[model samples]
Target chain A: MADPAGAPCVEVVDLHKRFGALEVLRGVSFAVDRGSVVSIIGASGSGKSTLLRCINYLEQPTSGEVRIDGEPIGIERRADGSERRRSMREIGRFRRDLGMVFQQFNLWPHLTVLGNVVEAPIRVRGLPRRQAMELARACLERVQLSEKSSEYPARLSGGQQQRVAIARALAMQPKVMLFDEATSSLDPELTGEVLEVMRGLAVDGTTMIVVTHEMGFAREVSDRVIFLHGGLIEEEGPPAQVFGTPRSERCRQFLAKLLH
Target chain B: MGNWERLVWNQRNVLLDGFLVTLEICAIAFAVAVAAGLGLALLRLYVRPLRWPAIMWIEYCRATPIYVQLMWVNYVWPEILGWPTTFYTAGWVALALQSSGYLAETFRTGIENIGRGQREAAYAVGMSPLLTFRRIILPQVLVTIAPSIVTQFTVIVKSSTLVSVITVQDLMFQSQRLVNVWFEPIEILTATAAIYILFIFAVSAAGKALADRLRLRYGLGT
Candidate 1:
C-alpha cells in the first residue's frame, strides 16, 4: 500500500534498548522509505535483531521512539511532558500495520498453511471469512505455496515453511515488512527458495527492513545498506558505496571476513 | 460362588444406583475442576495483583488430603458459609477443589512449555495477548498436555471415593451399607474393592485412549 508522499514508511529515532545491566541497543536510528528495501548487516549480537524487534515493540526500547506510517507506537508523549507506555490494545493497533518474519519460521504447528495466512486477517482485521480466504490464497500464490495450502507446517521443509511464513505476513498487507534473519536457520540449499520470494517482494516495491547475514542478497537487492557495529550504525549508504569502499575500517574488515 | 451371587448379583440394583451417584459426582467435580483450574492458571500467569492469591489457593488444595478436605467441606463449609446445604453439593465441591489444584499446575506447565517465539509471532500478527493465549497458546497446550489432563481425571475419580465418608451414598457407601446389614464383611468388602478397581481401570483406559487419539491427530508429533 502507498504511504502519503514524502513521509517515510517507518522511522526510528534515537532508539536505545537496555536489558537490565546489558545495553543491547545504544542510540540506534534509521528510517525506511516506502517502496524501498534497507538491509541491516552486522556480526552476531550487534543488536540487529533487537532493533528490528523494537520497531514492532516486541521488545520495548528503554528510551527513544519508533513510528510506523508517521505515528509513534508503544509509548505516548503527553502534553505534561510525561511518557507512558501505551496499553497493549493501543500497541496492537499500530502493530497491525507492520508484518514481521522471524528467523525461526515460527509457524503455528497446529494450523494449516492457509489457516496461518488467514487467521490474523479474519481475527485482527475482522475481514469476513470468505474475503480472508481470498486474500490468503493470493498471498499463498505470491509465495508459490498455493498447492500446499491445506498442509500443516510440520510437513513442509524449512524453505517451504519460511515461504508460508512470508505469505502469512503478506496476507496482512502491512505498510512495512520486517525480516529478522528470515533464512538464517535454513540449510544452504534451501535458502535460495525463501530468498527468491523475498526478492520478488523487493522487486514489487514492498517497503522492507531486513536484518540479515545474507551478504549477496543485501548487496544486490537492497537499495541501501546499513552496517551495525556493537549497538550503533557504523556505516551506511547505497550498497555499492558501502560495500565497495567502506569509510569505516571495521565495516571493510567485516565485509572482507564474510566474503572470504 | 454362592456368596458372590447373593451379595453382589442379588443387590445389583442398589449397587447400580450407587454407581450412578458416583458417576454424577465425578462428572460434576471434573467439569468444575477443568473450568476453575484454567481460570486459576490464567490468573496466576497473567493477573498481576491476584497471582499470589491464586497460587496460595492452588497450594492449599494440593497439600490437603482428600479425606480431610471432604470432611472439612462437608462439616465446616455449611457452618461457616451457610451454603452447600446438602451433602452431595459438599461432595462434588470438595472433590473439585483438590483436582483443580493439580489441574492448574498441569495447565501451567503446558502453557510454559510453549516456545516464546510462538507468542511473539502471534503478537507480530496483531493478536492481543488474550487472543494469542486463546488461539495460539491454548490449542498447542491442550494437545501437549492431553495425557496429563487424562491422568488428572483419573485422579479425580479415585479421590471421589472419599466423599462416601460424608454420607453421599456413592458406590462405596452403598457397598459398605450392604456389609453392615449382613455383617458378612468378607464377600461384600472384597466385591466392593473389586468393583472400585474395575471402575477406575475402565475410566483410565478410556481416558488414555482418547488422549492418545487426540495426540496423534493434532500433536506436533510427525
Candidate 2:
C-alpha cells in the first residue's frame, strides 16, 4: 500500500477566481491525500463546481496556483512579464492523470457508447485500436454497462449516461477522479444507480474528490467532508466529526435546513 | 409533326448539356467553399492572432452582394494584376469566396453551439484539442451543419446562374439563347425557374433523408 502522508496527490494554494465583478472563490486552500475520498458539500452558487473546474485548469484562476502530483496546472508569467498559458497539448498530457465526471454527463452524442469510451484512449493516448477497445470493454463492465456498449448516449437514461461518462473517464486510466455533482441532474432511481458505482469505486480505494448534495452519500462514502459556504470552506473534518458533532452556528443552521 | 419531334429532340439535348455544365460549376465551387470555410473557421476559433482578420474577411465577403463580387472579380482583379486567367475560373473563384463567407459562419456557429461542458469533458479525458476537435467536435459539427450546408449548396446552384454574365454557358445562358432564337421570353424563363425549383426540391429531400439517417444511426436527435 502507498503511504498516504508522504505526498499529497493534489494541492491548491490561495486560489481565487472571479468572473468579471462576481468573486466566486476567495483564498481557497486545500489538499487531498492519495487514495482517500474527499467530499465537498456546498449549497448552490457556493463555488464548489468552480473549485473542481480549477483543479484540472478547465477554468483558469484569477490568482493562485494548483499542483497535481507536483505538476503545475495553470499559467506562469516570465521575468519580462509575458504570461504564458500551457499549450493544449501540454494541458492534455497533464490532464491524463485527472478525470472529471460532469453533472450534465456531457457524453458525445455523435459517438456510440463504445466509441465514447474508446475515443480518448485511442486518440490522445495513441493506444492500439484493439487494446483501446479491450480497455473500453473492461470499463463498461465495471460500470455494469457492457451490454449497452452498442447504444448511443441519447438512448440511455440519465443514470446510464452518467455511468457511461464515468466509464469514458475510467478508460483513460486516471490516477484521480473528480465528480462535480455527478448525480445532481439525475432522478432518484437513476441517482441511486450512479451512487452505487461511486460507492464501489470508494471500496476499491480509487482516489476521488466529489461535490454533491447527497448528505446520505456524504455520510456513507466520504473519509473526509468539507462544507463550502459563501465562497469559502466553512468547516471540514472527518465525516462523523463534521456531521455528528456540531461546532459552528452556521454549520448547525445549514444542517438544520438540510435535515428539514 | 416532324417540327414537334425536332423541337423535343433539340430542347432535351440542349437542356441536358446545360444541366451538366451547371452541376460541374456547382461541384467545383461547393468543394472550394466548404474547404475554405472550414479552414477559416478553424483559424478563427484556435488562433487568437488570426481571429479578427478571419472575422473581417468573412464579414467583408458576406456583406458584399454576390453579383457585385462576381462582376468585380470577373473584370477587375485580372485587369489590375494583368493576369490571363479565364473568365470561367474567375467566376468560380468569386462564387466560391462569397459562399465561403456564409459557410464559415455556419461552421463557427456549429462549433460554438457545442456546450462548454463538452470541451471540458474532452479535456478531462486527456484528449488534446486537435483530437477533441477532429474526433469529437468536427463529427458533431458535420451532423449539426449538414442541413445548413445543403441549403447553402442549393442556393449556390441557383447562384451558378450568375455565371451567365461571365461568359460561362450555364443553364440560364442556354435558356437566354433559346429565348433570343425562339422569341418566347415567358416560356424559356418559366422553364428555367421550373428546373431550378426541381433541383432545389431534390436537394432538400436528399438533405432531409441524410439528416434522418444520421440521427437514427448516431442517436443525435434523441
Superposition error at A151 for model 2 (Å): 1.3
Clashing pairs in 2: none
Place model 1 in a CAPRI quality band.
medium
Local accuracy of candidate 1 as per-residue lDDT tens digits, A9-63: 8999999999999998999888888899999999999999999999999998999
Chain A only, candidate 1, TM-score: 0.96
In model 2, the Cα lDDT at residue A20 comes to 94
Predicted model with the maximum lDDT: 1
Off by over 4 Å in 2: A1-5, A75-85, B1-4, B43-52, B82-84, B181-192, B216-222
TM-score of chain B of each: 0.94, 0.91
- List interface RMSDs for the candidates, in order: 1.3, 1.4
Question: Per-residue CA lDDT of candidate 2, range A1-260, in tens?
Answer: 34344557888888999999999999888888888999998779999999999888888889888877755676655789787777767777878888889999999988889999998899888899999999999999999999999998888999999999999989998878999999999998789999999999999989899999999999899999988887788899989988888576677788889999
Candidate 1 ranges beyond 4 A from true positions: A1-5, A77-84
Each model's DockQ score = 0.69, 0.69
